[model samples]
Target: TQLLEQSPQFLSIQEGENLTVYCNSSSVFSSLQWYRQEPGEGPVLLVTVVTGGEVKKLKRLTFQFGDARKDSSLHITAAQPGDTGLYLCAGLPSGAGSYQLTFGKGTKLSVIP
Candidate 1:
């Protein structure tokens, strides 16, 4: 079984602050994805990283995949209150043969204005 562990399960910061969260796993993955979710809504896909050391940026958010494909990170720059939500990291293990995604516990972010 593949499992992902996310650090600092919850985060609270003021608007304009920057934060970085991590997702780690013992298993190697073929691809990893990040998502953001709001109250009463399903998670929205933010970015997908397939190559090792690949980085993708969306406005103030940045996503990076580790060189070994066993970890990933999300960094937010100058976060806003509107950025407050649940952030999730999911991975597709290599040769899983199924479409099931292994997800981290998730990080709940609260940006106070």
Candidate 2:
């Protein structure tokens, strides 16, 4: 079974600051996805990386897939209070046929205004 691990299980920062969070796995993935969830709400898909070494940007946030497709990172610049939430990383194993995904323990971020 493939497992994804995220670092710094929780974080607190002030608005306007920048932070980076990481997701890693021992196995290669066919694709990796990042999601953000707010209290009492389902996680919202932020981005998906399919190609190794690919980088995607969403407003103030940037997502990058490692060259080996075994790791990824999310970077937020000039964070705002609205950015406070739980960040989750999920991955589809390279040869998996089903839609099953391996998820990492989420990182909860609190942005102080």
Candidate 3:
């Protein structure tokens, strides 16, 4: 089984500030997805990275997959209070098909206005 470690279990910042969260593992993955979860709700998909060294941008948010596909990062520029949530990273292991996933504990972010 692959294990993913997420850094900075909690983060608090003022609105308009920037922050980056990370997910790392020793095992390679076929794809990685980032999600945001609000209180009392399931996580919502933010982005997915499939290729090594690939980067995707969603509005002011950027997502990147490491060259080895064993790590990923999510960066938010000019963070807003609406961005406050638990950010999770999940990976689909190679040859594991689409049913199983290894997930990180998640980074909880709080953006204060």
Which predicted model would earn the best lDDT? 3
Q: List the candidate 2 regions with Cα displacement exceeding 4 Å.
A: 96-98
Each prediction's TM-score against the native? Answer: 0.97, 0.97, 0.96
| C-alpha-based local distance difference test score of model 1 | 0.95
Model 2: how far is 110 from its true place, Å? 0.2
- Best of the two (1, 3) by lDDT: 3
* Per-residue lDDT of candidate 3, residues 43-108 (tens digit): 999999999999999999999999999999999999999999999999999873556888999999
Return the lDDT, model 3, position 51: 99
The reply for model 1, stretches above 4 Å from the true place, is none
- Cα error, candidate 2, residue 38 (Å): 0.6
What overall lDDT goes with each candidate model? 0.95, 0.95, 0.96
lDDT-sorted candidate list, best first: 3, 2, 1
Output the worst ten-in-a-row residue range by lDDT, candidate 2: 94-103
As for candidate 1, its clashing pairs are: none
Superposition error at 56 for model 3 (Å): 0.1
TM-score of candidate 2 versus the correct structure, residues matched by position: 0.97
